[model samples]
Target chain A: MQTMVETRNLRKTYSRPDGSTIEAVKGVNLEIQQGEIFSLLGPNGAGKTTTISMISGLVEPTEGDATIGGFSITKQSMEAKRLMGFVPQEIALYPELSARQNLAFFGRMYGMGGKALRRRVDELLEFVDLADRQNDRIDTFSGGMKRRVNIAAGLLNSPPLVYMDEPTVGIDPQNRRRVLDTVKLLRDEHNMTVLYTTHLMEEAQELSDRVAIMDHGEIIAMGTQDELTQQVGEEDRLEFTIGAQEIAEAVFERIQGETPGVTRILFNPPEQLDEDSSVFAPALLTVFAKRGRTALPQILQELDSAGVEIQSVAVREPDLEAVFLALTGRALRD
Target chain B: MRSILTIILNDLQIFFSQRGNLPGLLVIPVLLTLVVGWSIGQIGGGGPTRLRVDLIDLDQSGMSAQLIEDLRAANDTLVLCPLDNDAEDFCRLDDEPLPLERAIERARTGRTSALIVIPAGYATALENFERVVIDYYSLSDPLQPGLVLQSLNAVLQRASTASMIPGVAGALLDNVISAAQLPPLEGETRDGFLRALYLRSQQLLTERPSPVSFRVADSDGSSGSVLDNGFSQSAPGMGSLYVMFTVLGGMSVLLRERRQWTLQRLMALPITRAQILGAKIGVYFTLGIVQYAIVFAVGAAVGMEFGSSPIAFLAVMAAFVLCITALTFALAPWIKSEGQANGLVLLLSLSLAPLGGAWWPLEIVPEFMQTIGHISPVAWAMDAFHDLILYNGGFRDVLPEVGVLLATAAVLFAVGIRGFRYE
Candidate 1:
């Protein structure tokens, strides 16, 4: 397959008002093949947006460069931008304008006009299942409806490459699922390359053909689901939620040694829910074991004997979340 | 270029689509033009009211008739009582001759505004180029001349100047002949030659049109008819004020666009940043011109004069609109919130509009205030409009005002384009 996008040591540094410098993207390198869905998965503030912005030519990189279809984004921006569509995280549309109007305008910006632009707008509206609401002002539509139109605007030019920066952000779950399916449809039916950025591990797991796991402006891992999970040694994650209480650190060590098949253990103490709230959230204990289901009862009994009050228990298979935790020593949601 | 036009069209469509914007863009401006125009007309001595000035020509000479004609020409508002008198048939020969004393009594009692008495021998005095004392009788105070007295004085000054020119020229001719040691001509022949020379000189002065002229209407001496000068001043004034209102309102819209990320999306397109900036600027500029057109259309409907040069009028409109558009863009980047942008728009428009003499003529203000008012672009635009509307001036007359506005626009555009926020 031909590479659709390639980055070389891409970096972005921001200068604070006080003259301090902070690196948002640190010497990142990436390659995405045509007709594949590539995901940049990370927590909030992990430089996902900055990277996408640089690639989309919305922002300039401090150092290095990115090329779309062998056209350097910074050097040949107009040519490179013509080949790709960018769907920003915000609605990024004129709310007073109808969806069809917005689509036609963006289509014209891409050099499409006349009946061709109109036809493309109609087709995209229908594809997004928003044809009935195409004539309504975007401000009058629901959040999910607006998001669909935003996605449709990106597809107006029929570009081979599209960059979607958290397209599912702030929408209902059903709409988010619909957007995911539409993303899949783009790759499956149109054979278009997609670069999707999200902080949700589940979304990246479900949609990406290949994933680059980023943390603190660095991509710590990149591989298929199996390849990434294998790095954590085939272990499953066993989680125990306990009532708010203090527990000795020795309890986790004792439980890990006594529970069969258990390889490692991590625990989190109770936390305050909010600034004004007096209630404390349940503490969590996560155990990594070769066979999580078999070891759950033993781990629960060991915690029970240690005088730990258990609230709930769950056994999770090794997935992106576990991969992220294993590599970064932090939960994906953290 | 096509992309820029498309962006401009899209922005305009969106702007017009909002029903809330229509009142500010169209209705209020038109309404204000009419209201303000009529109000100023009333303030300007009740809308072209004609002053009734009675004329009692005891001399009944051709010179006295000519003087009456000159007064009639000087001010349309001067209603010569005998020429326009109709109620009691007082000017008819069948009725008893209205005496000069009665006319003066009528003027003093305010039945007529003023009375001019041309005594006997007026024609002989004028023919011989001798000094003539023409009595001007009026109830108006000499310190504060009424419209009738002012018109009378203006015509008399021209007459006196014409009369003096012949005597001066004849004396100079006589001196020249005597200096050359030529024999002095006998009385009849010399007088005839001097008389012909004076007639020719008077004709030459009368043929040349006055550089300054007024366009007041002659009323029936009851009260003034509705004057168009009020609308003439109000149309451009209110139009410019509303232009500032409409164009500066773009600051808030632009901030909202940035917050919505539509501006960022445009930057990500194939179009260059310059194209997007130009398109945005074009949108507000077009709207400003449209706003002016609406107000001026109202002015036209109500009989307002657009001066002798329509193209210069359009230039003034264009320059002012461009300047305001630049101001909008220059301030848009520093606005942090839509609310702040809204407040700033109101503050700038309200303050600048009044400061620039949009509410009244700069001529009415103090010289120091007028100098300070020119700091506002609205003042420059209003000054150009006044030249076109009030002075009957052409393009050349308004070049300085237009140049000032255009230069200000250029400087503002430089700052706006340089500091523009593309992302």
Candidate 2:
């Protein structure tokens, strides 16, 4: 029940070269439960890094507070830093040192020593699948291999809470998958709380138990996938082919009034359909019958009189992508 | 503490892991000690040190010729060139002359040292029992010129007095015989008188000698070589210059630690920043002490003797180390990169070495230059060292320098710590 990571009205402001202020992070308040894999999603420069930096104690908040493992990040910096392992956006490992040496160096920095330190380093290396490359210097490794070692170094001391900021950036697909799998394994095996930040919505959707979508330094939405999807709820979408031009106003109104499941209605007049349909009456009859709305002969008669063309009709369920689009009013990618 | 130890150990490992970096570090210290130490005491070893002096034959008599021969015999070290020849063989060979334009061109184009000229009637006046004036044409001002002239005059005086004694003794013997009213005798008497007079003149000339006159050019020579008076005495002083360079290396290590983010990682542990800084300073102090010990021991082995108390020497060296450590810390804020730190360390350490009397003694420098040297911690340290090594002074003599160094170190340490950043 403990909150592994928490922020209260956290805000950070940076001064620009033109003497203007940019609010990098603003009024972010959230609680991440212990051993939970929490993912934060945002566009580039959307305060994701700033928020992580504040929580990790790498940067001080311009206003408000953050805590890691029950210790205030600002007041109890060392204690908070001790409890949280931060894998920065950039690889911080020394390129000249071998994997084992890099691991040992970071491990010892956290006060780990002796046989225990060696054991931790070995375990972490094995988990990252870089056991074979453990003795080779990082400069010699490929991008994927180096990334694996980078993750391994972060896991050296085995802090209960680890924050990975774009951990799989600039890596091959194979390595990216390896990193994602490793992160999942670490959580499941060690019961470690993870607060991961990425701009990839799919990555967040796949790995996060709960996601907080940040935009322009604000958390626009935060919830489980179901809860957020329900934000655009599972509406029954019904599409109808109605042949109409002039005489369908009353019929359309009647249809709208009668159907309780129709979430949206689009009426394209017969003339608007690009079809080989000078025969509007036959197409209309077929469309109504196919829809099991044959009892509504008045609508067909009205569509035939209006000379409307009926091509196709269908209904589909609202998906998470739709929900995100509905909430943000822009494609998740754009 | 453990975290700091890890950092230090890791740093040491990284430093030694590379075959190149280790050799570079080791070579710098060794090369500086050996090359600098060996070259310190060597004065004009590649050639001769010339003294510029003018020759004036005021006597112009046969007696003057004898005087000149005696002068030449007195100090074979003197190169008695004629008036027409420029005595600035050292300055001329260096290609640098008195004028800045000429000196620059010559320095860029040729080689030389100094100039000497002879005034007319120098020997004639000497024969007349008047002081002969011989001009020394040098671009240097009074102090060096005056000192060289005094020493040269002493040599010349001994020679002239020896030459005059025989003539004076002959004249005195003739007077003595006449005063005794001895009758004019035959061939044996004349021969006997001549032998007695010759022997007596020889004895008189050997007994007492007259002083010689030496005149120095009143013009202050712009050629800086005139100030190159103390190479023989300043070699040990030069050796002290490099102590700062070694200490500066310790500061560079601090810069590298910060740049590498090792300090930040260390601070994340239980250890405080102050503790880490203290450990670094402590290590550097230890290193400095060891370096000083080796240098002093080696110096002693090579016939450089210290004062009665070795404690004074050790204390002065410790003070020097402390001062350098402080200066290094002060420079920490200003050095943004490892390359910059290294460059600054080299430039500052080398530049200050000469100014601080590490290359030469302040005693031989111009008055203003001596005053300026007081501003250098190395200067204060060198002065204290000189007291210990050259004068055999005890702790009391070095206390002032120690206090100054301690104060400077304290100030610099405070500033350096204040300016330090983890990344």
Best by lDDT: 1
Estimate, for each residue in B1-423, the C-alpha lDDT of model 2 and write its tens digit: 666566656655665576765433444444554454444334322112233233444345555555555455444434443422344231222233243333233222212222232335654444433565554444335565443445556655654554355446546666877899876344766546645654455356645543443332322433323222222234335445556666687666776666654454454444566767776776666556656665555555445556566677777778778878778777876776778888887798777877887755565578689778888887888777665554345686678788998888899888888987554
Model 1 CA deviation exceeding 4 Å by range = B45-226
User: Candidate 2 regions off by >4 Å?
Assistant: A14-22, A232-334, B44-264, B276-346
Quantify all predictions' global Cα lDDT against the true fold: 0.84, 0.63
Which interface RMSD values do the candidates have, in the order shown?
0.8, 2.8
The 10-residue segment with the lowest total lDDT in model 1 chain B:
B88-97
What is chain B's TM-score across the candidates, in the order shown? Answer: 0.64, 0.53
For A163-232, candidate 2 gives per-residue lDDT tens digits of: 8888888998888998898888878989998999998877887788888888889998888877876786
Q: Per-residue CA lDDT of candidate 1, range A176-200, in tens? A: 9999999999999999999999999
The best candidate by TM-score is 1
lDDT of 2 at A213: 84
